[model samples]
Target chain A: MQRPYNFSAGPAAMPVEVLQQAAAEMLDWHGSGMSVMEMSHRGKEFMSIIETAEADLRELLAVPPNFRILFMQGGGLGENAIVPLNLSRGGVVDFVVTGSWSQKSFKEARKFCDPHLAASNEADCHTRLPAPGSWQLSPDAQYVHLCSNETIHGVELHELPDLKALGSNAPLVIDFSSHVASRTVDWRRVGLAFGGAQKNLGPAGVTLVVVREDLLGHALSICPSAFDYKTVADNGSMYNTPPTYGIYMAGLTFQWLKRQSEGNLRGIAAMEHRNMAKAELLYGFIDQSSFYVNKVATDCRSRMNVPFFLRDESRNEAFLAGAKAAGLLQLKGHKSVGGMRASLYNAMPLEGVQALVAYMRDFEQKLA
Target chain B: MQRPYNFSAGPAAMPVEVLQQAAAEMLDWHGSGMSVMEMSHRGKEFMSIIETAEADLRELLAVPPNFRILFMQGGGLGENAIVPLNLSRGGVVDFVVTGSWSQKSFKEARKFCDPHLAASNEADCHTRLPAPGSWQLSPDAQYVHLCSNETIHGVELHELPDLKALGSNAPLVIDFSSHVASRTVDWRRVGLAFGGAQKNLGPAGVTLVVVREDLLGHALSICPSAFDYKTVADNGSMYNTPPTYGIYMAGLTFQWLKRQSEGNLRGIAAMEHRNMAKAELLYGFIDQSSFYVNKVATDCRSRMNVPFFLRDESRNEAFLAGAKAAGLLQLKGHKSVGGMRASLYNAMPLEGVQALVAYMRDFEQKLA
Candidate 1:
């Protein structure tokens, strides 16, 4: 059966191969006589699963030796509180609010620490980035937080700001939920990076936290042991079960990632190239057409989530129905922002985007 | 192929029917073109899934009208601190320490509030529960905490203690991870109950929180919004993106539970009967033999997790291998307490228990 191209913002479409492999191994994983979900986290079979997953993710992302990868529960929202609980120590923290996610992070952190909005783009409907030069760096801030990619608003940070270069000694924390693994991470400028695995990784319920070695043991006394980054890192994410099945599927994805090749690039490098092509295919058609428009600035637009509005709003439901009939799914934008969002994650092949663009043109011609 | 009778404490074995249903629905759920994992949590499809799962569980447990069921992330370990974060209010709280899980709970709760040990069975290596009448209840205690079943020590509170009857005005909180769904809960005696789904329910990532309506709004300022019961309950477990696939599998298990019928009993009523029989089979066999022993008192022995020691400890490895060859898996006890634990949850059939007992007898005969 031909499945529609799933464009969900999260718990999103996984690679077809990953799903197939997972389904094949649903009852027994590699002759272990138990599904990965059924194996004890401490058992050797599951230990190997977690270890290989962590290793592959480290390799795919080129994670630094000085950083630790901890698999945790609680998606990005849970981390909004967990991050502050672990790092704040009741000190002031600065935030550069780019879009909804970082804005939510700042608000949630206020309950645990003194959160100061160092910069924001709410004045412009979050279409552009706040110039980094204008950020007010707090001298005593525990960390400066930002969302590298805004899943809802379709804003992406093409380059990370080095806090040291900005004359701030605080470690930079980025919520890279939507665009993780689609592009390279500048780890040197980051103290901690966290993302829910749903969007670009494998599934929900598994959260990935990459924290610098120096930031390890400063969790406040009130931090939950399972959410405590230090405890999780120390226990190898077995601090509490570690979402065994999700890790196994993600491990399969990482293995798939390692084998992804495009042009002169391979692995994540190849994935980034293919993602760029897919985004170019969809956005180029939108830019050249009179019937559709993308509001985000060219330089700051997200490659993963592309939100576009139809020239005639009355055609929305009809367009969605036609899109569904044509084998496209979950393209509806977030409720807070009404439009259409085509999230072309690492899983959406270039052909899928080409088909979408072709359908859009044919539909536009019919409307004309 | 015949599957093994797995005995891992948690991330434990599930009902085979649940696995089959999950596999069948791996691509499409009902007539929806998306897998449950692919559905938006707010969308109609996933909402129906959550509502059905909640309703089935409510029916199975006979939960009262005033209780709110919250499907959350972070396992029991996360709840160790989350419970105090939400209920402790930085006020005095009393804990009845019985075994490893409760001891960990007490230690983590100390980080959030002044958690005093009102009673303890540590003096007897957690072999017995302290007499309820002897506990020195704190007058201003926020709540009195206890593990209804100590998964590690194989001890259970066959009868829940009533705080009012014991001269305490505080509410009672129970962690019922290893035995939830296998028996019934007395909601009149519980203020809040939480457990990870890996054991009796479904998978590792989903944590079930059933809180009293009156206990909703008292979370400390230090609580993360995601872990805060009020925020979670109000949003219908979508304050954050939930573990979608985990919820789907749990929903399947709930259906399995609801359809269960044995003799004149049905559903959870039937589950309790089968659990009693399974526990009796294994324990009765162990009791009749000189080669094995279970230390917990017969009145307090866990119907779900039965921890037993071989008469000769030197043959432990050989016993495990023999059991594995006989299609009984993961019978080894927790590393902290070296012995064998056979957790016969709702998922384990009486025949599985009989198979385990037969294997145990065969191994003992061979050793002789």
Candidate 2:
């Protein structure tokens, strides 16, 4: 049976194989006579599960040994507050507002620190990226934060900026929620990277944080102990029951990513290659058609979430109904941006994008 | 095929039926063609899920209309800081420390508020409850906090204290993580009740917060917006992505609880009767035996978690091994307290506890 290709921004689709494996092991995980959800966090079984998950995630991301991987709760919005609480230290912080997510982060940080907007693409309607060289970095800023990929506006930073070259000593923090594990990350340029697992990882309950060791112990006194980077690292993310089942599912996804192969490339490399191909196919079709147009600049277009609009806005409902009939689901754009969005995350195959393009062409022909 | 009887304290055993239903629906839920984990939290499918779960839980607990049930993350320990951040108003808060859980709560809250120890059972090594009358009610205290059931020390408050009756009008905040849904709560006496769903509800990621409507919005500026009670309540727990799959599993558990029957009783009342019977059988055996003993006072003993010790310390390993071989699992006590614990949660049938008692008897006789 063919499954529908889901296009929701997030809590998004997961690998079919992972879902099947989890179903098979739902009652008894490896003869333990308990589901993964039923095992105690401190039990040897769950300990192994979390340990393996951390190890696999580290391997997939090529996370440096100096970085600690902590599994936590609360999505990106929660981290918007938690980040400032831990890193802000009631001092000045720098932000590069590229889209809706960074705008939120900027607003939330005001509660904990002096947040300054270093650069913004709002003047360009978030269709282009603000040049890193143009950013006015604070000399004593604790960290410079940005969303690596904006799910809403379909804009992505293909390469991270080197803060040292930009004359800033502050560490770079990236909210990688939308595109983590979809490609390789340059950890050398990062002080911390956090993402909600719902988008590209596994489920909605868990948030993954990879922070540098030196950046760990500086959490402000007001930070919740469970969210204190130093405390979470010290307890191995077990400081407050670390979303056991979500961690388990993320572990499965990491294993799935490891097994992915494309020609000579494998693992994250293979995924990146496949993602590029899928993005190219969909975006190419949209750009060539007069009926469909993506507003984001070509150089900064997101390789994961592709947002486009129909020239004939009157056919929005009809397009969605036809898409659903063709098993292309959740194609509606965010309310704030009225159009259509197709998020091609790690789980979305090349064929799914092909099917979407095919459906779009067929719909346009019918209208003609 | 026989399944092992698991006694893990939290992240404990779920009803086999719930697990089976979750497994069967793992790939597609109600013809939605998407796993619960894959559905968007804002989508109609997940909205229905969270709504139904809240309604069912409220119905089961007979929750007053004035109380808002907020599905959150970060567990009970997370609530330690969250509770004070939202309610303490940076002023004095009183605590009645009964065991290890409440002790942790007291320590974490000091970071956010002026925490006063109104009463403590630590002098008795958490074996008994401090009488409500003996509590030093603070005239200007924001709220008085206590753990309804201490999972580690096996101490429980059978009845919630009325602060007004105790000559204090401060709201009573109870951490009922271990005993929620196991028995009915007197909402009239509670200002707020919070619990990690891992214990009696479902999984670890989702924390259930049933708060009085009037207590909705007093979050400290430092509180993470995702965790602010008012922000969460106003957004219907969608201020951030909620633990979607956990909420769904909790919904299944609520249904399972509703279907429970014991003699003439039904639902939570039925589970309470069965829980009482299970506790009596196990505690009766331990109290009557020469080889085993429970240290908690009889009047305050936990019906959910019963911790006991082997009279002969040398037989601890043997007892645990034998229990495992006899299809009994996770009977080891928390490391802080050296002994054994058999948590008879809502999922543990009366037969599981009976089997545990039978195994203890046979082990004791063999040693003799």
Candidate 3:
């Protein structure tokens, strides 16, 4: 049976094969006589599962040797506070706000440190990115924060900026919740990168944190020990029970990623190539059509989340109802930003985007 | 096929039925065309899931209208810091350290509040609980904390102490991680009760917090908003994308708990009766056998986790190997406490305990 294509921003679609394998092994994982969910976190079975998951994720991302991959609970929003708690050290922190998520991070960090607005695309209504060279870097800033992809506003930083070249020696922190694994990350420019697994990873429960080695052990005294990077790293993210099932599912996803191939590309590279195609297909059609439009700047448009508006806003409900009828789901835009959004995450195949574009054309012609 | 009996301390064994149901619905939950893991937390499908789960759990626990049930991430250890950050107000908070879990809570709480040890079992090696009468309650203490069941030390507080009767009106905070659903809680005496779902509920990603309404809002400035009880309660734990799949699995476990029956008893009461029977059978055999011994005080011995040691210390490895061969897994005790621990959680059938006893008898005979 064909599954409906899902376009929700997060807790989104997973690879069908990964879900099937998880279902098949839910009762007894590799004849261990226990589901991955039922294994003790400290037991050899689960320890091996977590270790392999971390290692596979490392290989998939080519994470640097000095980076520590910490599997944690609480999504990107939770990390908003946890990051400042660990890195801010009650000092000045700079934020380059591109959209809603970075705005939230900046606001939340104010409770922990001196959060400075280094640059903001809010002046343009978050439809574009502020060039890195235009950013106002704090001379005493401990770190600079940005959201690489805004799931809601549909803006993405395709390339990470070199902070030293941008006249700041501070570490850069990126909230890559929506676009992680859909593309490559430049680790040399990143001090820490965190994302909720709900988008491109696997599920909602696990949050992935990859932090540079030197950034560890600097958590504020009030930081929850479970979320303390040094503590989490020291214990291999088992300082508390590390979202056992979520990690296992994400491991399956990492394995699925490894098996992916598109022409000469494989793994993350393959995903990036496919994601670009899917985004370009949908955006190309929208750009050509008179009935629908995406307003984000061409250079900063997100490949994962595509927010579009119909020329006549009265057709919004009808658009959603028709999309549902056409086996498309969750196309409604975020409540904060009214319209429609089609999130083309790593798992969303090119065929799904083609189907969406075809449906849009059909609807437009009918309306005309 | 017969599944092996598991005896791990936590992230322990679950009911075979729960695993089977989860597997069956993994790809498509109730024809929603989405796995529970993939459902948007705010979408109708997941809202129904969380609401039903909360309702069923409230029904099972007989939670009062004045108390709010929160589904959160961050296990019990995370709560160690969160509880104080929300409740302590940086004031003098009292702790009754029964064992390792409570001791850790006390230590973590010191970061957020002036933690005062009102009572401690450490001098006695955590083998017994310090009586309520012996506790030195502080006049200005904000709350008194204790682990109702020490998962590591195999001790339990069968009944919570009334702080009011002891001349202190501080709310009683119980970490019931190891035995939450095994029996009913006296909500009147409990201002708050929190536990990680991995023990009796389901998976490791979700933490359950049932707090009195009056205890709602007063979090420290440094508290992460996601971990703030007021924010969590006000948003019905949707402040951050909750551990969606974990909540769903835990909902399944709650449903399983509701379906359970024991003669005239049902639900939590039924599990309590069955748990008592299982505990008595295992402890009875151990007490009668000269080959093994359990060191915890008889009155406070945990019905869920029974830690015992063979008199012959050199045979620990052989004992574990034999137990594994007999399809009893993870019987090895906590690293801090070297002994075999058989946890008889709600899911463990009486037959599993009988099988364990029979294995123990055979092992003793072989040693002889």
Clashing pairs for model 3 are none
Model 1 per-residue lDDT tens digits across residues B281-345: 99999999999999988888999999999989999999988888888998899989998999898
Give lDDT tens digits, candidate 3, residues A1-368: 78999888889999999999999999999999999988999988999999999999999999999999999988998999999999999999999999999999999998999999999999999999999999999999999999999999999999999999988999999999999999999999999999999999988989999999999999998788999999999999988888999999999999999999999999999999999999999999999999999999999999999999998999999999999989888899998999999999988899999999999999999999
Off by over 4 Å in 3: none
Residue B260 miss distance in model 2 (angstroms)? 1.0
Candidate order, lDDT descending: 2, 3, 1
Give the per-residue lDDT digits (tens) of candidate 2, residues A1-368.
78999988999999999999999999999999999999999999999999999999999999999999999988899899899888988999999999999999999999999999999999999999999999999999999999999999999999999999999999999999999999999999999999999988999999999999998888888888888989999999998888999999999999999999999998999999999999999999999999999999999999999999999899999999999899998899988998999999999999999999999999999888
Local distance difference test, per candidate?
A: 0.90, 0.95, 0.94
True-contact fraction per candidate equals 0.68, 0.82, 0.78
lDDT tens digits, residue span B146-264, model 3: 89999999999999898999999899999999999999899989999999999899999999999998988888988888999999988989999988999999999999999999898
Model 2 residue B324 lDDT score:
93
Poorly placed runs, candidate 1 (over 4 Å): none
Q: How well does each candidate superpose onto the true structure, as a TM-score? A: 0.98, 0.99, 0.99
lDDT of 1 by residue, A73-120 (tens): 899999999999899988999999999999999999988899999999
